[model samples]
Target chain A: MTSEIRQFLFESLTVMKYSTADMDDDTVLGPAGADLESLALAELSLRVEDHFGVRFEEDEAEMFAAMTVGEFCAEVARRVQTASAT
Target chain B: MSRGVAVTGIGLVSPVGTVVEEVFDAVCAGRSALVRPPEGHALHGVVDVAAIGPAIDPESVIPPKDARVVDRSIVMAVRAAEDALADAAIEVGRDVDPYRVAIVLSGVGGLETLARQAVERSTRGRLGISPFMLPGVLPNMAAARVAIKFGVRGYTSSSGTACAAGGQSIGEAVRILRSGEADVVVCGCTEAPLFPTFADAFGNALALARGWADPTAASRPFDRRRNGFVLGEGAGVLVLERAEFARARGATVHAQVLGWGATSDGYHPTTPRPDGSSAAESMRLALRDAGLSTADIGYLNAHGTGTKAGDAAETMAIRGVYGDDMPPVSSTKGVTGHMLGASGVVEASIAIMALRKGVLPPTHNLDDPDPACDLDHVRGEPRTTDVAAVMSNSFGFGGHNVSVILGRAGG
Candidate 1:
């Protein structure tokens, strides 16, 4: 599950044109190197929606803030699983 | 603050041609550069691509390492800026102070590279993402990169007011110069949103023309059969300098930017106000800024995107602003299609050329003009007329309305 989450995160960053070579699960995403701008983040959200078939609450945007690749994937996976269970 | 700004140099990269000379010739001859997309692309009408000349090389303007970080839109802006600066004979690092130079670029779509990367990641997983994605995807990065490339250290900014971005950028640049923030301002817009997702979005909205096999006939602005606007990509740049500065430097002036006005409808996200109040107000304010009455203006470069609502709204706006004594108006979009954010600057440049050459280019493919659009649209061939002052209009999504007035150099 952790590896699956990591794979998802990797794919997300790749789509944003960020190099994921040095990125680990713990790598920070912010205004730093891996940080996506507001427009990019919005686009990323749409992609996530299309990929996972799960609708995220607009308030979850704050949760995305400062999230590392692994954390983002885990959150997405959690939401996806919860949505599926429902 | 009291003085006007002079357009010292102009550069254009459009469907008509890449360079200013080529574009000017095409404009004068009333040639259409709209072409049908390749099969299976799922686009309607014409798609205008950058007319890259064989003699010019992209590598000459941008190094390979730096070029990779930028999208096609940024590349077009840099290329146009280079041409304008060279044409003006402004000696960089010598006669010009880098600190006094500013860059204001307007665009709608930022780095489409990021969006494409997102798609790839969704299908192939995180391992497929590129390292340089973040820096390449930001909208402001284009202006930032242009400033770095040109060594401009002062007042670097960008505007993204949809299609009105270009006009607003130029107006802001002029204000910057007038306000003494910068002595020389490089103002323009570039956009290349021909990506799959963008096409899907526009197509889904029914904003793109469909079922038109012939490109030239697809973007028929003000014509009865006009279905929608064609998507186009290009850049147009103008060097705006204080009139006094231009005179002091003995630079050749193209035209005087007399006044500019911008406003928002606060109405719809995509559709403009049916009453055209906001658009008319912008034109009135622009005329007021120029200290000229509507009677002084000779021609108008319209923001005619070939859309049903847009065309009708703009027509109502023009009639409201100019009343029964409306000037001859034409939409270059008939030939160039809709250039999105770059359309404002491109059409403004065309207006400047018309003022200089004393010839108004016809609205190509407007064989049957709509009775609703009652303005005297120069049809078929270009017309020879003494144009003293001209008004250019650009209204964007989100109800952004911008108007700018330009006059002959001496006028």
Candidate 2:
């Protein structure tokens, strides 16, 4: 599930036109790394939420740029499990 | 502050094509870009015919995520702005002070973006809308995006002067440079108004050319068979620099904007003043400002949009200014269609090219000239002339009239 979430994030970043050839689990999702801005982050988060049937809280959306790829993927994995259980 | 201004660089994305030389060649050869939008085109069924530029991928300039959010108007503006800057070899903060540069882009920007976003909100709900929608849809966003792309942090603004916006931008740039506010200005207009809703407005108003089996012949400016102007989309940008500064910097001067005149008809919202008194006044003012007599201007780029009222009024204005023996005149709109605000600068560029090449681009589709628009029309074939100066005119729906005079490069 974590790998699946990571792959989804990679595909989403590619679609968003972020240079992800050197992107990795440790890569920051935004300015310091993939360079996604607030708007792009919001778009990526929404796409993830819709695809996984999970959601990012308002604060999480704001911190999207600060989170690493691994951290974001793990968070989405947890949310997907929670959504399924609920 | 009446400082001399020179057009050092020109960037155009018109129906004729993007490259400056190529667009000039197409115009001189009378190649029409007006046609029925191809099947599966966004405007295929929205309107009958328009002078449409080639398909552009906004992502080619902007990042995909951001490109998808912003309007096509921004994309075209940035492209033209880039080309204009490269052509002039002017870099903000390097060649000239960043604070001493300005951008005066003009047009009804983001119309297609606004229309598309409104539909998305209706179908996808409010929450599904991107937060970037508003920023991307504002009329000034095209100018803003270009400024952001180039780090132009000077007196940046846009003109909403309808079809005259493009001409007004150049005029405004001259004003800014003359005032010593900026040494260089990236001035022009961009438009992406080829959408269904906008098409409906013009179509229902009986303002669009119709019943033309061959779309290429639809935009017949000054022709007796002309019905109305065909709409077009594109951007035209000019890198205007203070003449002294441009010469000092060893810039490649294309043509010097000797003078410009701006006026208002104050007549009607949609109709031109039949007498074209104010429009003629603008021409007289431009000639006077340029320190030239009517005979000095060897070529005239007219504001003839192929519409009966517009062509006739412009003819009156031209005759009122130059009398019976007017300079060789042509309206490129016969080929380019009416690009609204962008037409002003694009036509100005064409006039400058004509001056440089000693060849005037002919008015396409002028098979039968209207008696009311009787003038020295450069019809059927390009006219070669050794002209040192030229006048380009642009008149908009809001009674806005602008006539600009350009002299030979370095002269």
Candidate 3:
């Protein structure tokens, strides 16, 4: 699940036209790293929601930008587990 | 009689070309961009025919992710605006004051985006709506996006004068410059009404060209067999600066906007006044403002939309204004199809190019001119003449009429 989440994360960023070459576990998604803005983060969150069947709020999507790629993937995996268990 | 507005740069996106010179060459060579939407086209099987401009590469202008959210129409306008600025070699805050530049663009609001989004939301419910939908569907977003992208801080406006919007926007730019509100003005319009739903409106109203075997032959303005105007999608942008401002900056001058006139029919919403008295007044007002008489114009780019009543009314209007010595006239719509609001600036750019080349482009499909539209129609082939000045007119639904006069720089 973690690896799949990571793959989806990189693929989404790539499709969004962000270069993920230098990105890794420590790189954040916001200005500190990939520099995705509010709209872009919202779009990325929606894409994840569509793919994983896990929902996210608008405010939660903005918080995604502050998380590192590793942390984001982990958060998504936790949400998917919680959504499917219910 | 009027302040000379210098056209320093032109960016034109049409069925023929995107570069001003390329579009000019195709128009001069009489190549038609009108064609039936090919299979798999979004409008294919919906509208019988149209003049579709080249598809813009979204990634070129916006980030791939953001491209999906921003309206296609806005991106195209921004690209054209950028090209116009590059052509003029003017940079806000560096070459000219950022606060002294105005952006006035116009078009039928975002029918394409709105119609499509409405469909998606209907099928999927509330969550289907995108966050950027509101800004994408706003009519003023064209001018707003241009102003935002370029950091233009001066007066920004959008005209909703229907088909006359493009001309009125330029007229408004001249007013803004003359008001001492701006030094350089970015003026133009963008339209992308190619959706199936939008096509249905014109198709149902019987306002679209139909039953033509060949799409290129669909739009025949002033021709005896003329039926209706073919829908076209594109944008036109031009950078206009004060004549002295352009001269001081040593910018290349494409043409000089000597004068402009705008009027209303007060008759009908969709149909023009049959007697064309109000339309003729528009021409006379333009001439009066330019301090030129009827004999001064070398060619007239008419608002002949190939419709039965529109061509006749415009012809009567021209005859009422110029009578027997009417200048050589043509309607490039036979080649470009009707671009609706975008036609005015595109036609004005074509007229400017015609003046510069001393060659008048002929009406593409005007093989048999109607007796009602009788005048010296430039047809069969391009006419070679040392024309110094030209006129381009645009009339829209709701009776809006605009006539703009262009002349060789300092002529």
Candidate 4:
């Protein structure tokens, strides 16, 4: 799941003229990876939700502020698990 | 209590040409870009000839998916902005503080997107409308897109004053610099007004030139045979900076923005004051703001849109301001066609070029001047003269009038 999220992020970064050679799960997602702005972050969030079939509530959307790609993927996976159990 | 602003760079994406030198030469040579609509076009029979510029390839400028949402006005604005910054030798985040840079763009909003989406909503219902519909058609999107692309975090704004928006944007930019708000500003206007609905509206208003066999000869400003204005499309952007800032950075200054004046006719919605008093006041205000007299001005770029009312009114305004000693005047709209909101900045750029090159561009197709527009009109060929100062005028549909003065570089 972490690898899949990392791949998705790397692909999205390509549209912003960023190369994937340096981007990774352990690398910081924004302000460190590609210095993404609010627009780019929102776009990334939309893409993530579309691909994973999981919804992020207004409160949980702050998970996008997660420092690294791994942290963001973990948050998404946790949300999906909780949703399935419910 | 004000500081002077200098124009360091100019970008043009117009029907005549894009490169500054090429456009300057074309305007001087009296080249016309107006042409009849291609067969099968929606407005082929409804509208007259249009001065359409070269195609703008969105795939090359923006990502495919991103380009799909925004209007072409935003695309053209971004292209012009990039060209302007490159010409100014500015690396926004590297040369100047990103936060101290500003953008003031002008346009008539995104009519194309609005027209298209309205149809989709009517035929296919609410779900057919894209989520990006609102963002695509907003009037401020051009400025916003340029700000986002260039990382110009400071003061981003747009103007929608009918046709005078471009000139007003530049004038507002001068105010911003004078107020010590920003060190640099990317200012101008862009328009994607060639869409069918817009063409139909202008045609329906009887504001477009018609009945000419040769489209190039259709826009004859200041000529007795002139019918009406020709609808043209293009964008022009200029990089403006404080005189001291440009000099300190060893940048090549193109011209100094001496003064700007804006006023309202307050009479009619589309027609200018026939007496031209209010327009004259705008010119006088600009001269007063520059602290210069009539004798100081070298050339006048009239907002002669090849229409009977507009041309005569602008001529009256010129006579009102200059009296018997009218400075040499010409209207490049005969060649470039009226670029609507973008005309002021484009003509201002051409005025700066005239100042730099020492040649007055002629009013193309002005073979027989109208008796009402009797002035020292530069016609037939380019006039060789020393232009120390030039005043460019723009009047929009909603009675908005603007006059901007630019002096030769270095004072």
Query: How large a fraction of the reference contact set does each model reproduce?
Result: 0.00, 0.35, 0.24, 0.00
DockQ of 1: 0.04
Candidate 4 has an interface RMSD (Å) of 5.2
* TM-scores for candidates 1 onward, in order: 0.80, 0.92, 0.92, 0.84
| Residues forming the 10-long window of minimal summed lDDT in candidate 4 chain B | B124-133
Give the poorly placed runs of model 1, Cα more than 4 Å off.
A1-86, B39-58
Which residue pairs clash in candidate 4? none
Instruction: Give the per-prediction TM-score of chain B.
Output: 0.94, 0.97, 0.98, 0.98
Q: Write the per-residue lDDT of candidate 3 for residues B1-411, one digit (tens) a residue.
A: 237689998887788889877887777787899888999888899987998988888777765666666676777777888889999999998999988999999888777789878987899665566666777889999888788778899889899998898888888888877777788999988888888887888788778888999888899999999989999988888899988789889999999988889899999989899999999998998898788999999999998889999999999999999997699999999988888888999999999989999999999899889999998999988999998889999999999999999999868
How far in Å is the alpha carbon of B22 misplaced in model 1? 2.5
lDDT of 1 by residue, B105-127 (tens): 87864557877788888987753
lDDT top scorer:
2
- What are the per-model DockQ values? 0.04, 0.38, 0.33, 0.09
Worst window of 10 by summed lDDT in candidate 2 chain B: B124-133
DockQ of 3: 0.33
Estimate the TM-score for candidate 4: 0.84
Candidate 3 chain B lDDT trough over 10 residues, lowest sum? B61-70
- Indicate the residue-level lDDT of B139 in model 3: 90
How many clashes in candidate 4? 0
lDDT of 1 by residue, A1-86 (tens): 55775776678667556678988877766556466655455556666776777676666654565787777778778888888999
- On the 0 to 100 scale, the lDDT of residue B50 in model 1 is 18
